[model samples]
Target: MSNQHRMHGVFAVPTTPYNADGTQNLEQLAAGVEHALDTGIGGILCLGATGEALALSRDERESQVRAVVEAAAGRAPVVVGCMAYAPAEMSELIAEAAALGADAAMITPPFYGGLPPEAAIAALRIVMAASELPVMVYNNPHSTGTDLQPSHLVELLDTGSFWSVKETSGAATRVRELRAALGDEVEVFIGADGIALEGFSQGASGWVAASAWLLPEQCQRLWDLSRDGRWGEAIELWKGLGAALGQIEDNPAFISLIKAALSRRGAEQGPVRPPLPSVDTESVDALLSTIDGIEGRALHV
Candidate 1:
């Protein structure tokens, strides 16, 4: 609302690293956070969609959140994605996030067949009741199947219970709608990486981009360019990084392809969690080619 703690800027939804046996790779995850912090972006979001948050167990998610908070060491705020089916479990994750010294939490409504607005608000309220920490309502209907719409979200903000939101609905028109309806009231963050330019242009404060794992400076450039009325430059950079976003945003499991791309860069954070599967050799090859294309453009520039 009043913008006191709006997560406004290039927030990175970094990938989670697992070992060959699918165990959590804390060391590699720490390294990823360090890279993100050094990227000079605004925040590092561990255990997010890009981090395979859903694929992680509750215990694993807590540990991952703690790992990112520790790695950051206050360089930038750590926003943990606390996702769960039940409200109690969500609250448990929120408490764990606060206990781990997380600066804020990005929470999504529970995904199921489809939830009513009442159920959605109830889930968010459960999360809000559990912690004194700021809570960001993360809406991505594509993932959740149901949502707490702008009207419902605005009402929540009016109560002073919830904090901010990361809007991943992937519609620029909705960005404009939220800003128009609650511009001076709520803290709105753009979530989708592909449509970042459009979202920011419509008045979103920042992005929790998937491409942030490799393209932090590019995201920063886009943010700065948009702020400075440099849409042309921002779009160029966004276009340049399109491949990386495609590998994740359109994929079944976002974390898998992200790690695959990182492997090409020599980070090699191992496989994605079970049910998500590792990226195939062909996908990996194409992703590397795309990265090379981006690098080639940079070189020519």
Candidate 2:
């Protein structure tokens, strides 16, 4: 399939693995990409929120993007998340990603000072002008502290600066609102894993999911069922994986949980970076139990 068509599916956002000495484990990052491809994911998103982009230095971020792109090697589209606070920085990142073979760029609004809608537009325009790759506007108000409402999104779409929007507002209704406003002109990717089913049901074109890092098969199944109009089956799958899916919402240290889960599955994803502690044994056990339950159900089915 063409990269544009492949963009609209389960885009796995893998965590950035760090060594015990607090350095980027590029080997593990590559392994994560291979794992995603092996499990039949549609695309890979590196340096995203789940990938802990903000905590890494510029060099580290670029290295991670290069590793993912090389590992993917055209097997799937690689999207690099640009979370810089300035347009110049975002542009530089996007340029580097494009040079390294990233299929697209995912950018959030100018953060830290919580820029208004107009400023966000300016920042996006600057980045859009700087890079040649298609841009996906990431509307993650929870972390960015700047919510790009439907109106702001419509304005951004009007500028023709974005190819799609990753709505992480944790609201299923936002999907309908975006579809109504943008009408099929722009793609809408559901960013919140907790609402993947609901958002897809409401006309979301794809999912930018963090859970796919560990639960790749289940995540793909969820997307397949939803896309095939098997709503009842999809809802049942979502309910069965509720505990595992809720980790992203219940814990602020979700990257840690992602690493822990991967470790349980025998992937050598190392520790999370500093300022984010490792997942506690109790939490790890709970996540393992949840995964075990899901696997058991799959066996029965």
Q: Which candidate is the best by TM-score?
A: 2
User: Candidate 1: how many backbone clashes?
Assistant: 1
In model 1, the runs with Cα more than 4 Å from the true position are 1-4, 49-51
Candidate 1's displacement at residue 217, Å, is: 2.1
Tell me how candidate 2 scores on lDDT: 0.82
In model 2, which runs have C-alpha deviations exceeding 4 angstroms? 1-6, 158-161
User: Can you give the TM-score per candidate against the true fold?
Assistant: 0.92, 0.94
In Å, residue 170's CA in model 1 sits off its true spot by 2.6
Instruction: Tell me, by lDDT, which candidate is best.
Output: 2
Point out the worst 10-residue segment of candidate 1 by lDDT: 154-163
Model 2 CA lDDT for position 219: 92
Model 1 agreement with the true structure over 39-98: per-residue lDDT tens digits = 688888777743567777778877888888899999898887778888787777778888
What TM-score would candidate 1 get against the native? 0.92
Error of 2 at 279 (Å): 2.1
TM-score, cand. 2 vs. native: 0.94
